[model samples]
Target: MSLRLHTLVHACAVVLAAGCLGATLWNGIAERGIALAFGVLVAVGELTRHNGPRVRQTAPLAAAGALAYALLGEAGGRPTHHDAAQIVTVVLAGSLLGSVPHVGRGPGPARDHLARRTLTVGFVAVCFQPLYARGTFDDWGGSAHALLLLALLSLSTLCDAVLAAALAHSRTGWPFPPVLRDELRALPGIGAAVVATGAVMALGVAVVGLWALPLLSVPLLLAQLSYRRYAAVRATYRQTITSLARATEIAGCTPAGHARRVAELSQSVGRDLGLTEPELTVLEYAALMHDIGQLSLVDPVPVGATAALPVPEQRRIALLGGAVVRQTGVDPRVAGIVERQADPHREQPLAARIVRVVNAYDEKSRTGGPGGPLTALEELRLGAGEYAPQVVESLARVLSRETRERDGLTRPGAG
Candidate 1:
């Protein structure tokens, strides 16, 4: 199924390339100087692509460059003559050329990246190229023209976000709303930079010619550096929390990998419950450190099965964990969830309820035997007074889906 989807995107690009390349060839490449400039801009952008960490958009410069070409109206007091097809051809050619050096690094994901870039640039060109060529914006002054370009870029941004989110949802099987919500939330930062860069390039070039590319790129470059720093700090912070979570294991207060299992399962359950990306992060942190309080106990619970402990004891440990989390400087929200996890379901927030349900599920499942998953799920359902029914049902569905996926993979002809 994944292969088929990639094939479809590739096939669509093939059709788009064919039509655009054919038209560009027929048109004999109007404004060769301008085309060459933007092409090189995009290539340079791609050449500097960051691979350090996962991000919504890896090559903001390339995207802004391509978009600038799509929205370009005039170069140094002279208007452009290329059509939308020519714009796509130029951008695609530049991207393929730029990617050649990275080919040895396994450029498989490049296909998807190129697909997104191609579609977005082509959309803007189709909308703006013909209109600009026909004098649609000729009467509009510089201010109006800039505003128009920005508005068009905003629409293009929305379409790109939708495409990215849909592709992510298909590939990961995560719920679409939260995936899209994450994509949209990520947009206002670098996404805005890309939009602004594209618009600025187009508008500035209309007056000052190609020189604007270098002059206008400084702020965007600063923004990119700032974003990279922010990503690094976040990675470091999460690592700190993960290391903290592992302390309980180091002290022999819990089974090996118990915190990790709880974190992963709780996150999956949180996604199934339609929590946004940020909400999921808090849930994950709380789950990882949920057992940290066990370290405070003079003697750990047998096998570290807190779910099987008495409620009052569980509450005491939860409070201790929350206190530890607070002192360690993790998000206070995470601490709140940990502190509230032992509360009755009705009294707990949604994240606390989810953590409580999934933590209990993990503990019960591990001890239930070969039929552990089913038995644990049944046990969770039976303890209806303590567990949130919605969360338990959501966990059951997630487990059931995972079981099906696992079974299918183990069957013959599975990849």
Candidate 2:
């Protein structure tokens, strides 16, 4: 089926299910209306969610989940203590239904992804119950209550980030600090939208009661659209860089697909070494452009010739490339990485270190100068000072995993 038609049909189904569920569960228009709004927001979030560069998918439902919990907390007939079962039921159902579009992609991964989201929302609900029972915001005016709600929502977000970072580290062998750093960095971009959505939901509940909840959909949907646009722009930027990178390869300055392969390998090593997504991004871009300086030479470095260059010549190429990249208004950090690729032993940024090792490995592997992947890895290991021991080891792990996957061999702990 066409994607648009499928999306439309799926949305209609979700809306219908939400309306029926809300109507069956709550007699009041306010309660049912809020439930419907929550359902739609969840569906929109699911449909629009984007996969990030580092294999992490943003959880777009946090704001919607907060709104739903707030609505339940403020409903007129609710008791002092909220019902855990009801919160779980509403959240799990909405999340599961919303995730239907993703199920076919990979059943296990999709289910795991949905479960994590459900648990996060459920945890937020549990956390809010005490505040709800106390009617913490009831006495406060709209502005005052909204501030309190924002504070509570921020706390919940922090908890979620921490939990997610921990899970990523455990599951993917990613390091804790970098994962946490990335999560924290992400907050300012999306957090404002989430805070606004929660505030609107709270205000709506305060003013018009449950009826105001459906109106919350407007802002929530806008936020989702904004995220979608941002993701598209990011994808475009990556593609543009990729295209530029290919230019060097086409010019015979590097081997075919050399930049892309280096980028992939560098990114893998960066991830295993616990670099933040931003760091990994810079690393990948630097790797892709590492040979760009060769374009300046009357006789460009031959494909796979970089590994054979003298140290001074290599440094000269890197410096020229760094200068060229700097002219393009790219991140100075990225330029620094390209410049430092020639001096792998120097104390440089973690990302630069990653590029150095992976770039060298790709060059060696391409030429098959000494041996193949195994020989390349040994050369990197021998230059432990030039390449960080951890980075070399990370590269080794990356290669091992790739080999196993290619050979269709299951590692001991792999599922």
RMSD of each: 2.4, 7.5
Q: What are the per-residue Cα lDDT tens digits for candidate 1 across 206-237?
A: 89999999888778777877888898898899
Number of the top lDDT candidate: 1
lDDT tens per residue, model 2, 25-114:
674233455556566656656655555544344545544554456435654434323344345455556666665776666442243354
- For residue 302, give model 2's deviation from the true position in Å: 3.8
Weakest 10 consecutive residues of candidate 1 by summed lDDT? 1-10
- The lDDT, on a scale of 0 to 1, for candidate 2 is 0.67
